[model samples]
Structure formats: structure tokens, C-alpha cells
Target: MTAGLRALRRRILTPALSSTSLEVRGFRKKNPTAQELLETVGRSFLEGYGRIVEAPDSQAAEPRLEAIPREFRGFAYEGAAMACSIMDALPGSGGRRLSGLLAGRGGAHTYMAYVGIGWAMARLPRMLHPDTEDTDPLLRWLILDGYGFHQAYFHTDRYVRGQHRERKLPWPEDQASYAHRAVDQGIGRALWFVGGTDVDAVLALVDAFPPARRGDLFSGVGLAATYAGGAGADELLRLREGVGAYRPQLLQGSAFAAEAREHAGLTVPHTHLATEVLCGMKPHEAAGVCREQRPGASDRVDMPAYETWRQGIAGALVSEGRS
Candidate 1:
């Protein structure tokens, strides 16, 4: 790690740049043994990244758990769990490297590592301030709220990739310049604050998809959870409830395509891992879903469209006096 990278990561920690500044690291290859990957993951945590490691794998068919080096145990279960999910999803068919699957698609671990950190930051407040009233609307509505909590709790970001740009907000008018800085810096810390393993669990599940696919999935599903009792509470709730009834079939590839066409008007296409987080499905569920829906699926998950829809909906809800 260079001092430049460290300073950059810190600078991004400012509230204004938090959400937009995404920290992507780890995974130089497809399946860089748990030991090697864990080292970088630990360094990332120490570097103010987030503390998340994978739990010991129970369903590995090959390379048995014993194969993992003893020294790697020091890393948190959250990181280990995420690593297992990434490794488990590689292309090999039967755990074979599948060459391009890991490297060609911008690296699964990188996507997940960033996601894991982001997830933790989003959830951190709950772990620390369990009882405190949340003053931050962003933290309260998106991260901690319960209702559509199903979507936000897990792989929503697998669809909603954070975008970077200058923007203004209605609240805290005096601190209007803070939005960009918040996305860049505070977002990471927000995710990290969520605690380690819980965040890792979400990423481990989502990391299976390629970046583009992840974005696409999130975009199609549109908005999930948003703020309540502030500005757009009523309308936002209506939209949330409208979206709440829709459920993913848990099938992959063509089914997703079919569902997209079928529900084109009513449902949004999101790569939301409902089964994984709520039902406690195994990590491989992500791989299974992707394998079924996306042919030649790379490790990328799309969040572009989902994000666009979110901003649009949020703005609409706020303006209509429903927030």
C-alpha cells in the first residue's frame, strides 16, 4: 500500500465524498488462496477499510477446508465467508479456475471486497448505536429501516452501484456541499460501521455476479427501501409496498430474462438476494442464480439502472410532499 492510497482513502472519508468514493481492493486473481487474500483483506481493515472475513466453509466439495493454511484463521469470519463465496462461484464447472471468469471480468473479489466494505459501513451504526435515535436520514431509511428491509439488508447494491458526482441536498442547507463528500468518504465508514461479518455475508452472497450484471440486475429492480416520516413518507411507502409483493423465483439466466419481459410493467429487475439474507440460504445461491439466468456470466453485478431509478423516485417522493 502506498502513502498516497492511504491519504486518498482518508480524504475520501469526509462526509461530502463518502457515498461516491468506492474503495475497490483485493483479488489479484481468480482464487488467490485464502491465506494470501486474507492478508490484503486484513490490511484493508487496518487501513480503515472494514473488518470482514469469511466464515469457515462447510459445503466445499474440493480443495477441502483443511487445505486452507492455518495462519489465515486470524482473519475475521466475515472475510473468510466472502472469500469462500467468491471462490465457490468461479467458472471451473466443478471448481476449475475457468481462466477468464476471475480475471477477465474485473475480478470477483474486487467487486465483493468493495461491496463487503460498503455493506459493513452501511450497517455499522446498528452495531454501535443500537438504541440511539438516528439523526442521519440516509442511515435510517436505507440502511436500518425494516419494511422493505428485505431488499436493503442484502444484495440491493448488487444492483445499486454508488455513482460519484457533485450534488446538493434539501436538508442541512448550511452543509449543502456535503453530499458528494459524504458519498465518497462517509459511505465507506457507514458501511464499515455496520460491523464485519454481517456486511461480509451480504457481499459474499452478491459477489458471485460480474460487475455489469450486478448493475443491470439492480437497475431493473429499481428502488427498494427509502426514507420515511420526513418528506416523501407516504408516496415512498406506497412505492415500497407496491414493490414489496414481488418476489424473485430464485432461478437463473433465462428465467430472469423471462421475468423481466413478463413483469416489465409492474416489477423491477433486481439481483436482490432475498433468499440468502432472509432465509439464510447458502452462499452458493448467488452463483446458482447467476448461472441459471446469465449465460457466459462474468463476475460483475450491475447497479447503474437501479441507482438512476432510486434518485428519480427519491426526488419524486420528496417533491410530492410524501417523504
Candidate 2:
């Protein structure tokens, strides 16, 4: 990459540039590959994630995740939103970039790539219709997600031909497969987060699938709800109690992950405190521990640990993307 492009990549990775600073990368049809974008996402929020949260409206593309509660940042929902926010900053060529990425073999490998696109699509309605306030945000989110999924799978941007209502899901599901059915299920999951905590739609979507396929679908639902801060400690506990025994740690871990990321972004000491709390330490004790260990700005933070915490939770959620 040219030095200019490298600098641009760094800038894009961190979140929420002031609206004034946007377009400085010089928008072109420069649709960087999925590999490039995947790399770029790493830095987007590393430096300024907390600042973005501190004053989200100052950014060019307002991150939808900022509107949600902070408890779910560890959830893939925030990942998706971050991905979407990144894509929104680019031009139409982003569709091509996303399509190329999706062409690869499916599995845990491509899960994050798909998430970036899903996040972008989720924000499209608001981006496209800035003044319109739809009564049903969940339904709106589903439409955007489905449309983007169709475009990615079918490799076309012109949805107007039929708006992808007639896409196929002929691929049979198995333990290793992520058929077109997974896309539909994921869209259903995004709905629960963008909408209220109402799970009626989520349960219905889960019922539509075999018990085997429900895990992948519900993973999205749980992650989205938690990551988007739609669920609190009480609600998370209730959700865990109600769901299959396979998912409690993940839901809780996602919340903790969000907390960790937030604290890390705000100040490194908070990161330690958050980790201690997640490891079953009392909040008061964790806070005291972190207070004593807090380091100066001259010292580098253990950002790797923070990233590891995020990846650990998100990776598990994506791995559940079975057929």
C-alpha cells in the first residue's frame, strides 16, 4: 500500500472521525478488497473508540451501536455495526468489495467478513432515509439485512428487478454447512436487537428451523440483543435461563466483553477492572485493584488482551454458525 493509503487505512480503522475530517481519504471507487477492509477494521476503533462513544454525532456516519446501551459491545451486533459504519463511509464500490469477500468458502473464516456487510446493510435504511422514522425499526433492519444478504450472495446491486424476494436456499443444511437459510436466520436475529427486547419474532424464526439450525440463528439474536445493549444483567440472566443450556456463558461473556472494550477504550486501568469483574470478582474489589495498578499514558496499554477478550467472545458466537 502507498503511504497515503496506509495512513487512510489507519484512519478508517478507528471510529467516529469528525464530520469535518470525513472524505479526507478522498472518496474514489477505490473498493479495497475484503482482506484490506478486514485489516482496516482492526484499527478503526483502537485509538478513539471511546471518543466516538463520547460524542457520536460529531462523526460523519453516526454509528448505530452508539445508540444502544453499552452492555453489548462484546456482542457481534456491535461488530456488525462497526463494519456497517465503515462501509457507509465508502462509495458504491463497497458492494463489489463485499461480494468478493462472500465468494470465499463459508465457515468461521468468513464470519467476520459477512458481519461487516450485515452491519452496513442494517444501517442503510437510516442512511438512505435520514428524515423518515419508521415505526418498526426491527422490520426495517430485517429488510436491509435481507437485501444486503441477497446482494452479496447473488453478486448484484440492482435489487429492483425483484428486490431479491425470489432468492433460493436450495443448499441442504448439515453440521458444516451455512446455507442460504443461515442468512434468513441471521436477519431474524438482527431484528431482536434493533427492535425492543421482544423475542416473539426471534422464537418464531427459531421454530421455523430444525433444532440443529436454530443454534446458528439464535447466536445472532443473542449477540445482537446483548451487544446492542438491548439486554441488561437481569434480562441477560432471564435470557440465559430460558434458552438452551448451551448458551449462557456466551450471552454473559458478550456483555462482559462490551464492558471490557468500553473500559479499555476509556482508560487502560478500567480494562483490568472489567476483566477482574468478569472473572467473578466483586465490582468493588475489582475497581480497587484497577485503581492501584493504573498506568500512565506514557505506558502502552495491554491492548492485545482487550482484543483477545473481544475475539474470544465473538469467535465463539460465529463458530456456532452451523448449518
Candidate 3:
């Protein structure tokens, strides 16, 4: 693409910075700190997206993404991954952009990258959705998680307030039913943002959902609480106590977040704090649980390895009596 065309694409594709504002999203502004932190995350994501849109290729966008502050860098990589996936899904685009990104520094941020692909899926038409057949069978569910987060973040009333749920997702053939569960996990993550790190508000929102859905939702909450860091010790403790029967799911999500941060070399103070409170261990220890529980080659037709992996983590938490 020519420079002028790249500029045009960047202009067309990038969302306005105000879109991240608490006022614009109508999300709760529990406090200035939480609001500012969440909005900064949105800005970082956009910066990464814009960088990729203007770059010649995903690899070319690396330096710009790396320049993002450590706390926000993973989110930028997510945005870059989202942009790359979107470009690959466009007609006659050769479909190599996302692959190239995952092959480089983006690999460390694989969890975020998969979520980014879900972001692309939300904007693209069904016909243009990138094939996930080659994606890691276990991690690919995060695409739906990302998709769920996008819908909840952008269409808050319908997905969060109205408690809407997709009937039958069309991707991941033969396992479409499981997609809703994964999406719920993303919605759960979004709830953390939507409620502005207010433990009570988030808990109330989750309680409104059906019983079967609460586990996945709480799992998302755990991931966001650990990864995002808006909630302090008191808030996290309340969150840990509030999850009730779903505590294991919450711990599983926390572990996943720890693993993602650990893998990306982005482990922050909040990461450690959240894991300590929610998982009864430090970030590395929680992440180690994730690594140990990861499933090997599995032909288990009853459940996807990804779900099996999640269950394994949750079960480990239970067995260890981690509260």
C-alpha cells in the first residue's frame, strides 16, 4: 500500500481517542484513578492499532509497539494483533499479516494476540472471518473471549446491561455451542471495566446472569482484575470473597492472567497482588499451575482441550485448598 493509502486506512480504521473515555462509554467512574487507568489502556490499544495500520507489515510495527510502557505494552501488542488480523481478512490481502506477527515478538503476547483476533472477528463480515483451524486448539477460544469483550465494551446495553447472549456462534465448526461459554468469559472480563473495578457492582452484574454462566463470567473477572490492576488489595479481597462457589473459576482466570503476563514479561505489581489474594499464591506460582495443567495431545471428543485446560487449573486450585 502507498503511504497516502496507509494514512487513509489508518484514519478510517482507528477509533477516536474519546471512545475510551468513561463518559463516552457510560461506564461507571468509581474513581479518577480507575477511570484514568482504564482509559489509558484504551489509548494504548489504539496506538498499537494505528502503528500497525501505518506500517508496511506486522514486523515493521514492532518498535512502536515496544515503545509502549511496560504496564500497557501488552495491550498495544493486542491492538497490533487485531489490526494485523483485520488486514489479513481483507480481500486479496494474502492473509499473512497475523501469522507474521505471531512469529515475532508478538509470540510472547500470544494470549492477548488471540484475543485481538476476536476483536477482528467482531468487525469483519462472517465471510471474511479468519480461519482459526490452525490456531492453537486450546487458546483459540480466547478469540471468542475477545469477541465477547468487544461486544460488551462497545454495545454495553445489549451485552452487559441487557444480559444478552449469542444463540449459536458460526465459527469453530462442531463446537459452536461452546463458543457462548468462551464469550461469557470475555463478558466477565469486560464487567471489570464496565463496573470500574467496583467489586460490588461487578458482583451484582454477574449475579444477574444465569447460574451456569456465572463460572465463566467470574473467570473473566479474575483475569481482568489480575491483568488490569485497577482494584487494590481491599477490592481484590472483596472480589475474592464475593465470587463464592465460583472461586475456583476465579482462581483459574487469575492464573491465566498471570501466565499471560509472565509469558509476555509484563508481570506488574498488581499482577502479583491479585494472584496472591485470589489464587493464594504469587503470580509465578499461579502461572506455574497453569503450565503444569496444560493438556498434552488429546483426542477427548467430549470437551475441547482449552476447556479441559481451564478445568484442570480450577481443579488444581480446589485440590490445593487455595482460597
Candidate 4:
């Protein structure tokens, strides 16, 4: 594509910046700093998305994405991944754009990239969703996580306020039944943003959901709180206390965030603080827990390896009395 055509493609594909504003999304503005930070995340995501769509390829977009500040670079990569996946899914655009990016520098941000694919899924039609049948079974669930977050973030009335649950997703044919749980995890993450990082409000929203679903929901909250860093020490402590019996699950989510941040070399001060408060360990230690408990390839088919990995991390936290 010519530069002009690519620029036009970017403009057509990218959502307007105003769409991310707290007022525009009908999300709360608990405080100015929190609102600004969250809005900045949206802006950074769009910047990344625009860069990838206008460039010739993911590699061609790297230098500009790399120019993003360290604090929000991961989100930019996420936006880029989302755009690449969207491009791959579009008819007549030769596929594998996502795979090629993943094989290159995007490897460091694998977790975010997969979530980005989920974002693409939200925008594309069911028939056009990226193929994940051959994706790592253990990590493909993260795509649903991304999808859930996208739904809850943009369609809050249905997924969050109405407390709707996705049932038996059509993708991942063999394990479709487990899709809703993964989606709920993403919803939980979005709730953190929806509530504007207000611990009490977010907890109230979680409590409103059916008891059975709260565990996965809390897990998402933990991941967002740790990775996104909107909540403070006291708020995190309150969240830890509020979760009660789901503490292990919450810690598991925190560990997942820690692992992603650590692996990508994006650990920030809030990551450390959140891990310390939520997981009773440093960010690296929490990430180590995730690494130590990751499940290897297994013939067992009763549960997805992804679930096993999560259960293992949660169990490890419980066994060590860290929860």
C-alpha cells in the first residue's frame, strides 16, 4: 500500500480519542490522576494502533512504537498487535501478519499481543476472527480474556451492569464450554477501569455478580490492579481484604500480571507495590511463582492446561500461606 493509502487506512480504522474519555465512556472519575492515567492508556493504545496500520509491516512500525515512554510501551505493542491481527483477518490481505510480529520483537510482549488479538476479535465478525486452533492451548485463553475486557470496557451496560455472561463461545471448538469463565476474567479486569479504581465501588460491582463467578472476576481485578497500577497501597490492602476466600485467586491474577511485566522487562514501581500487597511477595517473586507452577504439556484432557496453570499458581499461593 502507498503511504497515503496506509494513512487513510489508519484514520478509518482507529477509534476517536474522545471515545476513551471517562465522561464519554460513562466511567467514573474517582480522581484526576486516575482519570488522566487511564485516558493516557487509551491514547497510547490508539497511537500504537495507528502506527502499525500506517506502516508497511510490524517491523516497520517498531521504531515508532519503541519511542513510546516505558510506562505505556506495552499498551502500544498491544495496540499494534490488535491492528496486525485485524489486518490478517481482513479479506484479501495476506494473513500471518500477527504470527510474523509474534515471531519477531513482539515475542517479548506475547501476553499483551494475545490480548490484542482478542481486541481484534471484538471488532471483526465471527467468521473473520483470527485462527487460534493451532495457538498454544495454554495461552490462547488470554484471547478470550482480551475479548472479555473489550466487551466489558465498551459494552458495560450488557456485560457489567446487566451482569450478562457469555455462554459456549463458538471458537476453540473442543473447549468452547470454558470460554465464559475466561471472558469473565476479562470483565473483572475491565471493572477496575469502569469503577475508576475505586476499591469499594469495584468490590460492590463484583459482589453483585453471582457468587460462583466472583473468583474469576477477582482474579481479573488483581491482574488489572497489579499491571495497570491505578490503586494505591491502602486500596490494594482493602481489595485483598475484600476478596476474603478468593485471595488465592486474586494472588494468581497478580502473579500473572507480574510474569507478563517481568518477562517484558516492564516492571514499574506500582507493580512491585501491588505484588507486595496482594501476593505477599515482590514482583519478581510473584512472577517466579507463575513460572515455577506453569504446567508442562500433558495428555490429560479433563481441563485445559491454561486452567491447570492458573490452579497451580493459586494453589502454590495457598500452600505457601501467602494468600
Q: What are the RMSDs of all candidates, in order?
A: 18.7, 16.8, 1.3, 1.3
In model 4, residue pairs whose N, Cα or C atoms come closer than 3 Å (at least 3 residues apart or on different chains), thus clashing, are none
lDDT of 1 by residue, 235-312 (tens): 323322332222121112212222222221112112223222221222233333323332221211232222333334
- Candidate 2 lDDT, tens digit per residue, 1-323? 45566456546554443321213321111123322322232234232233222222223223433343333222223343334344435565232222222232211112232344344444455344211131122122232333333342233223212223334432122311223334544443433422234444345434554555445455455544433333344444545545564353334333333333443232233233332323233333333333333333231123323223333544443343410
Q: Measure candidate 1: CA RMSD.
A: 18.7
Q: For candidate 2, which ten residues in a row score worst on lDDT? A: 130-139
Model 4 residue 175 CA deviation in Å: 1.0
Backbone atom clashes (below 3 Å) for every candidate: 80, 9, 0, 0
- Model 4 gets an lDDT of 0.89
lDDT of 3 at 194: 94
Task: Please write out the lDDT profile of model 4 over residues 90-170, one tens digit for every residue.
Answer: 888788778777877888999998889899999998888888866776788899999999999999999999998766564
Q: Give the Cα-based TM-score of candidate 1 against the true structure.
A: 0.23
* Candidate 4 Cα misplacement greater than 4 A, ranges: 298-301
Worst 10 residues of 3 by lDDT: 296-305
- Lowest-sum lDDT 10-residue window in model 1: 222-231
TM-score of 3: 0.97
Give the residue spans of candidate 3 off by over 4 A: 2-4, 297-301
